[model samples]
Target: MRRPNIVWISTHDINPDLGCYAGVWPGAEYARTPNLDALARRGVRFDNAFAAAPICAPARSAIITGCFPTSIGTMHMRSKAVPPPDVRLLPEIMRAAGYYCTNNWFTDFQVDLPEIVFDDCSPEAHWRNRPTAETPFFAMFHGMATHESQLYLDDDAFAAATAHVAEADRHLPADAPLPPYYPDDEVFRTAWARYSDLITEMDHWVGGLVAELEEDGVLENTIVVFWSDHGKGMPRAKRWPNEAGLREPLIVSWPDRLPTGAGVTDLVHTMDLAPTMLALAGLEVPEAMQGVALFGGEGALRPQPNEFTFGGRDRQGEADDRSRTVRDPRFRYIRNYFPDKPAMIHTEYPDRLPTWAAFRRLASDECQQRARGELPSAMTAAQRAVVAQSKPSEELYDILADPHETVNLAAEPAHLDDLERLRAALDSWILEYGDLGAIPESDLEERWRPGGRRPATEPPEVALEAGVLSLRATTPGTLLGWTPDEPASAAEPSSFQSEIGLPAPDGRSWNLYTGPVAVGQPIWVKAWRIGFAPSDDIPVRVPVPV
Candidate 1:
């Protein structure tokens, strides 16, 4: 095969807990993951893999671009991920090289504006009538079931998984190894086991996918790469720079080509996945990829990748835009960009699900009793003395000594030398990457405002009383007629209040409309934009009580 086909399978919001990572604790050995384990046994397993970001969207963007998430202005998740139109995505690069690239149902960049990314979202969700074919093929399939939102899996699956969950495991897994941030308790154990249950379910899907490829006869020649976009949604892990949140599971399999049953401990960041995959496909990695290929020996005369796997955290945990972290094999250093806020906020609770309650109750208690634990004094002092103190923003920890990351050596007299060194390294690498975040804090507001996708013509909001509906419009955009569930017709403006504009030439966009939806009747509204953003469908449920 010229260069075998490439298939990248990624799951959302999960961490490495397989036969590979040798549980952060001993109990994690049983973290049900037969499928991922099989892949590990069949190919190369990376024990030290880190994500470019500890959250979704940004990390996914980084993995596909082979650059730090911050460089693309997608440092935060969906909130700040608007890349200007000129940026070249990985798939587009594949198209240039004559590879038939395809993706199943996702492209966060295309989610908001499909036209900007996909040539067409038809034929199938995001990959059918693609533009290339002379060379090898590349396709990405997302494991949506692993998303935390689906943790509320219909009650039936929950019942089956937990049916055998011991009362001990039900209250929590047997004396679970409390991550350093948490106090040992029932809530933490129970929640972790439930989370593990979800992991098992996700793994089954991964195993099924591998089997399908084998059936298709593409298993041997294709490069199968499996990874997560980022970390699990645990308090310190999900949004913070801590390992529980930043480390990722990266399993690569190509039975006949790449070495099998070999484990590479060299530190590799998730951002490298795109470039690495492209390299495997015989494609040139663009200059924009800030990562190195796993197969390419480190970068010096005897080139070896830096000893650390790297990533950062931006506004995704309890609150936002508050914390950051840098990790190497033995250390995890955190920078509290906003130190004034409580490290443990009430918002981290995933209130609707059972798993959220388990993790929360422990993290919440940890926040409540700062005096008893082995937590550093400065952290305690900062917690008590700072009213959202943004100072003493730096922290460094020796994970080998305290994997839970309980110590703060930033202020410790002996570690100051190492701390200053890492900070300078972080700043230098950040600047060299041309990351948008390096723009001096003072100029950020001026630099980032005009790129919003809110719409050239703002949608009108409607309110009605009796038979009349009030309408408002921007100076140049007119008010068309009523479209309760569909587009409002300009010819029937008298029947309902709506703006009559040039009809949108595209099919998926929508136009707004409102009329006398009787107080006691059922109705819904769809906002339309003919050639712009996706048709926004918001269902307004109104029922008159007898």
Candidate 2:
């Protein structure tokens, strides 16, 4: 039997709010996620899937590498740098295993992906573009309609923005229940309604992709997976380390090789997806990957049923905060590295929301009244907690009892044992991963930036012999490529770019150059180590005949 092709559809910031998850507020039917609902009924739904990090770039980096972002020095929100040279991405592994891979234009990869990793990586990237019909493929489609920015639209603007949505989907019922942290007002309700509409829109995109698979007659042979990058995109959700930030919806369907309609309640992290994909493709999971495969052949790594899943938070955009969390099924423990920093880390994106504006006004009003020696009675304890600058270093929550994470059980005597246990687990995880949060953010920046003082990759040695050019690097697995040194105004053709691999079958690290070139032509060659910066370009002139 042929290997199954894999299709991963990922969305932005949506938690398990789908109708199939059975956790949607007001009514499950209101979610209008018929496509995903049907997928859940036809596939395996993971009840306890979580992200290694709550924010986008870090979470995505963890998923793609099968390693904790902290371990790979990609814990920051927008590091805009590639992982260190030692780390290998899932696509690279899959490509090496003879699978065609494509990322549909959304790689918020904190780490850089080499050009060799994917056959295509544009908005139009798809499995259909593979070189041949017999080739197995892995493709990822990222949808952004349900992103947090969708909720930033005010009531009047939301109506205009979502005017394309059916009127029935445009508004939520007046009695819709909201999270206790949010005020029970129209602004909050309207925002929720708009968010729901965005989900519905995202669902439509999912349906379209599924239809395309069926139309291509490859649906049955394709393993379809759907998931979100992280938790919801609200104030206390996206950047926080609570359940609201870490939990994600995950569904996997493979009609030919696996059972359908199965529900997995195992605690699995998003990092597991990479190794799982590798296992599914009959490839060995690299030892450097920290996550287990969850499913595959007997050699696949699987975590225990009650094993704790870990999460971390670090500098997000311009805001700097550090926190780490470890959770089992019943409880979650959080340790804030910067206890003096406020729970609210200001970023320009969320500040645009009307709800966030109102929150800031209320907090400002309460502060002004306090400065005047008057106790503020209008703000609820929950509201004050949202903007409080100082927080306890440790927080323990009985997630089963306090799903919203409003009450801290860290100081409660009744849960002291549980707190200690989780605290130890978190500490062990941090040490095991070599949590990058231990380093100051400014220092990390200096170490990771393009010209920063990080580890250096020695440039390839270029030598011309017997009318041919040879390139070799001391760095094992360095990827070498070259282009002609043409005039600045000249357009370089695609043929000018070529990858040079190892020359001899027994040789360890040498690219026996292949060239029979015209005289007087100049060429520039460069080498790249996955986790380190590309080496300086070396210009070599095609020698004139003696």
Candidate 3:
């Protein structure tokens, strides 16, 4: 009767072990997604849909614009120095197409598109009040209630969340073998138990949203899709290329639109969302959109299948990282330009993970099988060396068999055919998408509160102009310097105030500020007091070239 309304619900870092997807929210007897399951029962359920980038900002960008994160230089979460003004996001398109587009608050500025989609990151972001049939709407919502390492809960909630787990729900089936690599230990189990509980909480939240939709009388006419940015934000799980990190649960529920209550195993990527929306809305998909819409009501169907979508690995330290993943329903091929550092290294050396990105804690039984494995004596030396190094430059996985992707069949003699094919395919994608490897490595974008200044180490050049020396304190902290020629001292200037906020740290350069410097004066300001560490002094010769 009406142009079907569109509602997209996205969550962060949640795997498919929940009740509606995997039963139990991966929790103890807690596949608690009755609402989602009920929704699924009425619509087409996608079994193999995936995020173009199994990450947050990247995935969000993909969904909003229907393009791969790498194609837009947005391969990693919080990587953009600033949100792009050119790329036409779906919300903008929908707005032009006469659809009201809105979202709850706090979307990263990197993905912010003015006059299209707006957010307010408060608890009330998801307030539902849409006009009935006046104009079709495309509303996107997010669930931040069950964030990783959710330690800010009230005492009672925290106690219950961290409660001990029972034995029965803690172990996998006897036939379910542990992955070749990984430890099986109480440390892993306990962490997994907590992780599951968190999922249960998220599921309960989703149920509420669904109930809201049903109550609003728009549930049936809406094209509803639910997904997560990535897997659980645990050690290797979050920032990893492994299946656990990349594998997500995607469920598409659209009643009486195309197909209903049937599982379509076709692989779908995140970026495809934008193109899909554009196509479904009877709008021409821009060539920039490297994705295609696969599901929708009238005018959404294509005569043939669209090409593959990609995922990128440019998060945190991986900023210099060049990685590309290509998948077509049957296979997933990955090429890591910097293979010297395997994903596991982040676990062994948490420092390997990006400073800006904080994954969930080590509190899950998901590692029990890995922990139980015997240490590899034949190559412990080599393995350790490899872990110390990055990963191999090339990797290929037979996803159907090794869904978890622990074994790097890249070297296996038997799968050479698939490997070469997928590798070529993955490489071709990198070229086609014009993915420049990690553009803003040192250009941090994640915002963390500026705590009091910490200690110091390296000192670079700072410049002073307009009575204010651009302190550029590495990243951002209180003003730190000495009178004229003080040997790079660290002090928190109580009187310091910045006109703008600090740029996030990409493991490099700080835009430290100094009070007011003399115009055209040669001031050597250095980053001394910092929030994390006193970083190397980055010397800047200011009086910026005009």
User: Could you tell which candidate, 1 or 2, scores higher by lDDT?
Assistant: 2
Report the lDDT tens digits of candidate 2 across residue range 406-498: 899999999989999998898788777787778887677777663565445577787776556677877765766555634233223232121
Better of 1 and 3 by TM-score: 1
132, model 1: CA deviation in Å?
12
Residues 16-106 of candidate 3 have per-residue lDDT tens digits of: 6655555312231443455566666766555556666655666676666665666655565554323232465565556556566666543
lDDT of 1 by residue, 1-546 (tens): 376777777887777766566744334565767788889888877767888776776777777667776766767555434344435467656644555566664555411322322223222432224344334666777766667665555668776644533443232367455454543455556556666776776777788778877876767877889998777765556655667777788988887667777767667888777777777777778776778888752211112465555566665533556455666666666776666665544453355455445544444555666757655332233223212224357878887787656667888988877787777767666667656654542244335444433343344465655534544443232322233444333233221111111122234322223234443333333332222333343344444445
Task: Give me the runs in candidate 1 sitting further than 4 Å from their true place.
Answer: 23-27, 80-86, 109-135, 151-157, 160-172, 297-303, 346-392, 438-546
Q: By how many angstroms RMSD does model 1 differ from the true structure?
A: 13.0
| CA lDDT, every model vs. true structure | 0.58, 0.75, 0.53
Q: What is the TM-score of each candidate against the true structure?
A: 0.70, 0.85, 0.67
lDDT of 3: 0.53
Q: Which candidate, 1 or 2, would have the higher TM-score against the true structure?
A: 2
Q: Least lDDT summed over 10 consecutive residues: which range in candidate 2?
A: 498-507
Ranking by lDDT: 2, 1, 3
